[model samples]
Target: MITRSERTLNYAVLVLFSVIALFPVLLILSTALSPDEIGAGGSALSLEFGNFAEAWEQGNFGSYMRTSVIVAVSVVTLATLFSVMAGYAFGTMQFRGSEVIFYLILLGIMVPAEALVVALYFDLRSVGLTNTLVAIVMPQVAQSVAFGTFWMRAYFRSSSREVVEAARLDGAGHWRTLWRVLVPMGRPAITTMIVLMFMWTWNEFLIPLVMATDESLRTAPLGLAFFQGQYTAGTSLLAAGAVLVALPVVVVYLFLQRHFIRGMVEGVAK
Candidate 1:
């Protein structure tokens, strides 16, 4: 229904915004590759790729990355599983107090984490979980599950009634109907949730900061903070470290971009 000029204008606006958003990323990448060593400089784009290596070694990013991967993977897996089951129940089944409980769960998303993190630290400490990876991961899982439940519930609620009725008529029980049918059909929504959870878990900072006192339990962002302090004068190294910290999130989004975008657009349309 749109005219050609309108479409062209829309594309131009999108391109302009894309470039504006990407400028900072490009600037960081350029600085990360810029020559840091003395007497080895040519242009700003000298392509001193060793800066990443030097930063990695100096920053002890390997350990930080491992911890982040562990926390991220654990939080995402547990949160996604729980969210799917909870969303399925809330979306499809009827029960007493269901609305009340669902709204209570929604409070987890509504409440600011900063408000609860201090108390949460003490609660975990009472259980002897402080300074452990469990402490770092559990809170994030709880947080992600809240939003994931909301996300998946919306998807399932609006899913095809005919498809669900057909599955029931085929003698499929709830479990079979969910895993064998609806879950498979909800791949885009699920993938979107997974990507989001992974990014959030990977980048979480405050929870890890409050929970972990041990150096080995530090997540990438926490490590990056320390790395920044240590390398205050080393701009190239700091830029490279930033890139390293962000690379996993970028890779994940790139890998799941199609499903993520489709899910977002569909959710909006519905």
Candidate 2:
């Protein structure tokens, strides 16, 4: 089934992309481990995450990391619950203006965050939520709902309906059928969504910047920005902070690699 030219072409493409993707990561890792004032000397210098400890202490990234975890977990948990319910209803139930309302929600996926972010700022201020962790978590939860709902709905749409129908005929309530039958069958999709949501929310920066003005509430990305303010210190610390900022995401992707692949396959099949 394999032709030499075709196999060579595919392998060549993969190798090229692999290098493209890995180049930046390698650079970051090199930057992170470089000696103090390393980046200052030249771009070609070989380095590692040597200054990470100093950067960690300087950024107090432990606290920042904790805040990020709290906000990300909260947003992922809340969004997953809301999106699953909304998606299930939209996928399976008939309701007035369901299509229209879903289209409005879909608009969120296209709308740039910067466009509505100013309005969001004022609205949160009006509610006295500015500078609060809740402010950051809330909007992310809302935005995540759109993509997550669309994804879950796609999977649910392709799924077998027989189990659900039989449960309904056996007097199982709608929620019961959804919880017991649908969710179990949709594990692959759900796992994928969870990983995606966690990654997005974890990396989110703009909303947190606009919302959590308190120094203590600042997340890793925001904290990185503050960490980079060089009027007070050198850039080596900043490189260290960068390594910390990227570490958790890399670890998660590596661990959840299997679940992520299954989710993508299942959702595409749907």
The best candidate in terms of TM-score:
1
Per-residue lDDT of 40-108 in model 1, one digit per residue for the tens?
A: 565544457677776777668878888998898899999999999999999988999989999888877
Model 2 C-alpha lDDT versus the unseen true structure: 0.80
TM-score of each: 0.85, 0.83
Q: What is the lDDT of residue 106 in candidate 1?
A: 80
Quote the positional error of residue 219 for candidate 1 in Å: 1.1
Off by over 4 Å in 1: 1-19, 37-47, 258-270
In model 1, the worst 10-residue window by lDDT is 261-270
Candidate 2, pairs of clashing residues: 32-48, 32-49, 33-48, 33-49, 33-50, 34-48
**Which candidate has the top score in lDDT?**
1
For candidate 2, report its TM-score: 0.83
Tens-digit lDDT track of model 2 for 133-230 = 77888888888888788887777788788888899899999999889889888887888899888888888888888888788999999998877774
